[model samples]
Target: MPLSGDLTGDGRISPMRSTAVGIRSTRNPRLEVPLGPFRPPGLSLTRGRAGFGSLVLIGALALSMSPAIPATTVRDQEVAGVATTGGEDPGIVGDSGGYATAVAQAHPHPNPIGRTDPGGVAARAVVPAVVPVVFGPRTDETTLRRVRTIRGQIRPKSVVASGAGLVIADNMMYRHSVTIYDTSGALIRTVKDRVTLAALGWPDFPTPVSGAPVEAAMSPDGATAYVTNYSMYGKGFARPGWDLATPKDRVDDSFVYRIDLASGTITGAARVGAVPKFIAASPDGRWIIVANWASWDLSVVDVATFREVRRIPVGPEPRGIAFLPDSRAAYVTTQYHDARRGYPAELYRLDVGDWTLEPIRTDLGHFPRHIVLDADGRYLYASMTGDVTVIKLDTTTGKIVASVRTGAAPRTIALSDDGLSLYVVNYDDDTLVKVGTADMRVLQRLATGHHPVGVTFEPSTRTVWVACYSGTLMLFHEEG
Candidate 1:
């Protein structure tokens, strides 16, 4: 629970404060890892600092951006018995003390994308290969002070910002909830619902139910936040054996819950493919696109109506996705760690105009995990896990330009809004890495908490927020 920030967007608002920005649960569903080609046992999948210091914000959420439509209603979800326990204060540091973990190439997480096993399978590769190398920004590391931490969930996946005062933390493992925080990093809402599973078409729910929420994206206007529900609560219709959830795998169709940030309501819920992992909106806010892991497709929804426009088929285990600045093309990365199918993971390119999906010739080898495009949309980056590297790809030529070596297992990859730097979350070593997008060099590699799963960039404050699977959100800001 490393809290950072001063409750303002560029130091304009009052100091941090908290009010009951109440949200009601509408009950919805929800949905990690890194690993290899030849294979390992427990492999699994899935940025920045002032480089905000002694900074802490305490106040009600307030934003300076243009508001989107207010949520007429919100879908609140709740897990039966999940609670938040605070972490011991580790004492603050100023751009100091974290250690960089080298690539051991040893003991990679077996569970790709955070699940037990896709159970081995031979995967098909339909494109040519293109490997690239990432070079400079060999910039140094700057450590930020640990000012505060949140104790609301067990394994928080990712924290999303809306250019407003509120940020949402998607909790994966226990509690299946999303913790909402003000820009100052104070917890405001934990979204969960107690709906009867029967209503969601699941006859089971012999008891009241809740959902496991994963990744989220906000509309351009900052009024609505879209969250992906990974799985359902109360029972095991997911598998044949009768057991609670041990491996963290879900079998049912997931959902996307829309929330009106300002009103604090879980506005609506829409069904998508199974195990929905990542979500993003078109630049114009016309559609909300979701990547469904188990379903092997993308769910495109009408933003204003929340209706499914199409369920576009992708390969398997699709993880991270990003749209070009013009919203013309989207790139998705897949974890080829499926043992049964044995499909080599790859990066798929979807042409927005024609709605066509084709694999991008990538040098990421057999397993590519995450992706993000530059603000200019000329180059795109992907975390090539099986190869233990991050690559910068040329969108025009569909070839690699450069590749940078990373720690044991690299999960998620993000870029600064200016596309000047890349931040990667290396899960196995609990490390956060920063690289200069310009030179393709490793700038900073700092240690994080146990199993860090999610990393998000807040351009408004030039801040980086890291969420740990063990329940903590650490904040950092770029220094001059």
Candidate 2:
């Protein structure tokens, strides 16, 4: 299986390198590379042999020219926007002309506030894996009410809240491989990422393998959680993945483990490309997309078959991903700036129906990492490592509408249930910042543990959870 590179822009393709079979060491900190001259050697635009489609085509997008947005000068100052009622239009402009109607028909589901159910298994159904949060009236102010800290022998790279009342922290090969907690910030169980691949249908090696869990995404129904491994350790694997890996690196492929939330066991594993970082289940629950860091491609796995259906080549170091509410499109962020080609941090949008990839140029600054869209898919928020801030983008027009100065190295972000409050974790600053979407102002900022990399919002308690790489899980409650 040679690597394909027709879409890497350099037009250089290379054959796959053989793995030097052995278990490799696991490290925690995801590299935050400095901006410099770096050129990607290749990109794999090939679909998987499972055959969703083999025809690889890159379409040039003719995006309408929009005025270049001036650099945001406002930092924490509140720049208010026009107020509107619950059903009134936000007046967001562009191609999503039906935004108002969509917002009107959208019924905001009241979060199960005090539910203590860990989570009940529901019959598997083919529905959207993720339901977009509906925007509600933002009349109430948000403030940090209290903070709770959960300490253990762990180095959490990320924490994900399964809207059904559970939160999982991927401990990145630490003593506790992964930690599970209830919505009330209590520990449920700590699971080790040790699994026998043969039992999961991989007959190549019958022995047990250990994976360094990086990030996780839950299925729409909340019955299952998909966790991506930074690298697999044990038999039949070699060459550990590096954070700043390039095409020249001969890294081994990784796996995405399927955790049955009810049973809390690793039920299945899908082999994906090297250094899989971010994983997301599509809203329609038909696919799971994994961003392969070293391989510079995406593994689009079919949920029904539990196998990769497509391997779409993206640019180097793809980190963050966000999908549209209708599951019609997915927006992926590539962190690497192709200085050789004069390209800044690039954002690619994949059309789900046709699997065509196109770059959506925006003036949202450099090193775009995590991204999240509003309920109506009108506004997109992305954290920029280069800018040390988060910019709000008008998705329809691909222009930065508003921005706020988040602290240095803002890693992951979480949007509130009502889509009115955005939570961001500054890894370098060891703090979490809450921003009001209406005015793009910092509502509050609270100190966190060391290297706070992951952040998530729990709708049940309306609390915020932050995962620190230095063994801490901090929970914060929002008060008016």
Candidate 3:
């Protein structure tokens, strides 16, 4: 059958026909994806009587159709600037100046404080798929808290918390991935949705077949979660955080999966620019900005329509993303480690009002990873890798005002609700450190699981949740 229509709903995957038998490997991570038009080479068209007369289209090509389930058709809409497929917008409450009002509302369901993962999944949790190894040495904090570790896959990369206390962690290697927890440092549910897809008519859909979920952001009202598939589209599995894509080189164009937090269903998927890393929803909840690593740009999506409205160009390998409370401008970290691009990662301010990309003043050996702004949005906090310091940047000056020493490779940093405390996740040392924003002194040194990549402060429980690549979700709470 010839491939026609959008395989994953991005015009990039075009239709094709072949006369010779061509077998393409489904697991080839190095598949050559042309930037010019991309046509699926999955079909093997051979010399036969019906070859010329045939027009084969795999309606379920990448959708992973299940033979037992009945088929359903969903029309595509011309939304924002791009097209959206899958299903209708049921979460949208009302439209105000093109913004989806319902989507911006927070989830009303509250989280349990101090308690952990759903229904004691920790004690009865299934054995690790692989022999369990230590992510870090067990310290007093680990022994004290009992560290509610949600183990499933090997590499749990990032975690995002919803307003209602829903914690979702990104699993890099396994299928039926994405472990979930509540506000109490307890496992709530596994994001693995096999039945939902089949019910939606895609029964046999294979899991990703390439990419995996890395970073996610929840809508203010807490109804939806938008997840970025780190390198899912073209050779995504080969790289975890960033995927390389150029207009003429490999396609590497990525996708963001829109999931219903309550339903455990993937409602829709939007195609963004190549190798999308960090995703952030504007405070106003009208727009979602994604930092594309390879294309050296940002895909700005309208929340109401879930479509890419603008692709803002920035520096190479942009990772961390932070939106101002007013949603006027955002601070982003452009990693300095790309050898092809050369030295000193830059920090740029993207003005949402005019869509202007301006770089902050700084130079030399400053490798930035994660960025978090103060509650008032007047100040900014960033974690720099090479220097191993959390540098405070004044919004007005755009220069580092203060710096504090910490463990190696600080990746994810979160600020307390009142902006009094800051939490930094050191990937190399596997420690979660809390620092006072005022004095910039090390407040707490809590050990974490292996390759601690994601950290978030939960207001409901007043606890901090950490997602470890060693397949553990470690939770820390302060005692009175």
Question: Which of the numbered candidates is closest to the native, going by highest lDDT?
Answer: 2
Write down the TM-score for model 3: 0.64
**Model 1 segments beyond 4 Å from truth?**
1-147, 193-208, 234-250, 337-345
Q: Estimate every model's Cα lDDT from 0 to 1.
A: 0.53, 0.64, 0.53
Per-residue CA lDDT of candidate 3, range 302-356, in tens? 7766678888766556777888766788877665422223211256677996787
Candidate 2 local lDDT, 1-480, one digit each (tens): 222222222211112322121111122233543222212111000000111122211111111222221111101222222233233322222221222222223212223332233321223432222222212124127566434566755667888877655778887755437777665444556678999999988999699889888898876655568899888878989776767675678788989988876557787889999989888777666778899988878899877667888898776678778877667888887775352332223566789967876556423456677888776678878887655799888877666788899898888887875567788899889889999888899988899988888888765345688888777788776654
How much is the lDDT of residue 155 in candidate 1? Answer: 57
Which ranges in model 3 have alpha carbons more than 4 Å from their true place?
1-147, 193-210, 233-248, 337-345
- Model 1, range 67-149, lDDT digits (tens) per residue? 22111111122212212224423222213222101100111111112212121111211111111111112123333333334
Q: Pick the winner on TM-score between candidates 1 and 3.
A: 1
Between candidates 1 and 2, the one scoring higher on TM-score is 2
Model 2 reaches what TM-score against the true structure? 0.73
Q: Total backbone clashes of model 2? A: 4
